[model samples]
Target: MKHLKKKKKLLTNDTFVIVPFYNEGKVLINVIKKLKNSFKNIICVDDGSNNKNQIGKHKLGVFLIKHPINLGQGAALQTGINYAIKKKAKTIVTFDADGQHSAKDAIEMIKLLKKNDLDLVQGSRFYKKQNNNIPFIRKLILRVATIIANFFDNTQFTDTHNGLRVFNLNFAKKINIKNNRMSHPHDINKLVSKYNFKFSEYPTNIKYTHYSLSKGQKNLNAINILFDILISQLIKK
Candidate 1:
């Protein structure tokens, strides 16, 4: 089993974990607690969550940003990234607020980023399946999407839409993310290839709970994603 090497030096003070949230009140608190010790800063962007009342007044020493309107996940993520940059973060790790990802795994991704000097380190679920309960339909969509992304963008990532990723501050700053919708992952992949940034993939475990599966993007969203990619390409052309 491959594991991310632990960095000899502690994570830089400029490293931050960015989590985009939307009505994930039940899980967010625990996620925050789990990750608080690993990174210097934790930025949680609440994307106009309807269940904000449920979140309560909990200050875990991490910065929380709120949006008045329900923006898409992509917008929330971008908001967090911008906040991290403003805070002078040198590295940003994009994490999920739904409790699907483990904080330890996030730390590993950071270590991998430092070890390989990679612009981005993406977590790949396809590398191993140890009690991972990924839905069949979602798995198939990801497989097809990964193939299309690799072929069209000349990239070889096993998991194209994994939210767990670490980005170097310099390369991340160059990314002009215009997609304010669910297709942002596709846009990011395209940008990585276009900029000729060094990217690597590492295995990470994703626990697919029923709540997460139901709340996740449906198969129909793939059409919108494809359309977004095409529109982006045409605009570039």
Candidate 2:
């Protein structure tokens, strides 16, 4: 029997961070500053924030792209991905601007991605659950959604909705992210399984603030996502 060869590890200089923003002006600034100290390149996509005062004069060393109107997180992410490709980024890390994800965790994810030779790395908040503040109802919904997503994709993933993830440039370019709305995270996982990309997961802390909790998607959105998925499957059939 022939043995499969192990893949090579990723390099530090090849990694870049992408942050999608809407009205997270000050929070976005803080995220960029923290990420700058760790990652070599950082890209910020302004998804048309109406705050004119917060638009100009950002201090962090980041490549900023702005949309005239709010284009949603998916569009902002796509913009950042395009910029990353143009800049010749070998690996791109997607980060949240809501101050939920930590810079230290990002560094660890990058290192793990390199060591494991994975095409994508996802952060799983439920792995340890250091914070007990996560609502029980939300947890149940996420669990059900994760089960459905795994069944459809034929892959096991602990956390399906976490925004903190890293992807290789090639794999990132191959994804057809049509949904410019809240369903992009699920799309990413489905694509990874569909494309047969190598992926891994790492535990990370998700700090929940009052603002973030308020801004988070409602429970009804999960039902909407399920409906969308069902419609998509039907259309394909």
Error of 1 at 206 (Å): 0.2
Candidate 2 contains a number of clashing pairs equal to 0
lDDT of 1 by residue, 1-237 (tens): 133223323345788888998888667788888887666588888999887534347767778889999878889988898888888988889998878888888887887888889999888898655446677888889888888777777788888888899998887787656777887877677767788998888788887887777777788888888887778767874
TM-score against native, each model: 0.89, 0.87
Question: Per-residue alpha-carbon lDDT of model 2 for 1-237, expressed as tens digits?
Answer: 111111122225567788888777567677777777677678888888877525358655567799888878888888888888888888889999888899888877877877788899998877665553678888888888888877776778888888899888768888666567776766688877788989998888888788777666678889877876666656763
* Positional deviation of residue 164's Cα in model 2 after best superposition, in angstroms: 0.4
Runs of candidate 2 exceeding 4 Å displacement: 1-13, 53-55, 128-132
- Give the Cα lDDT of each candidate: 0.80, 0.77
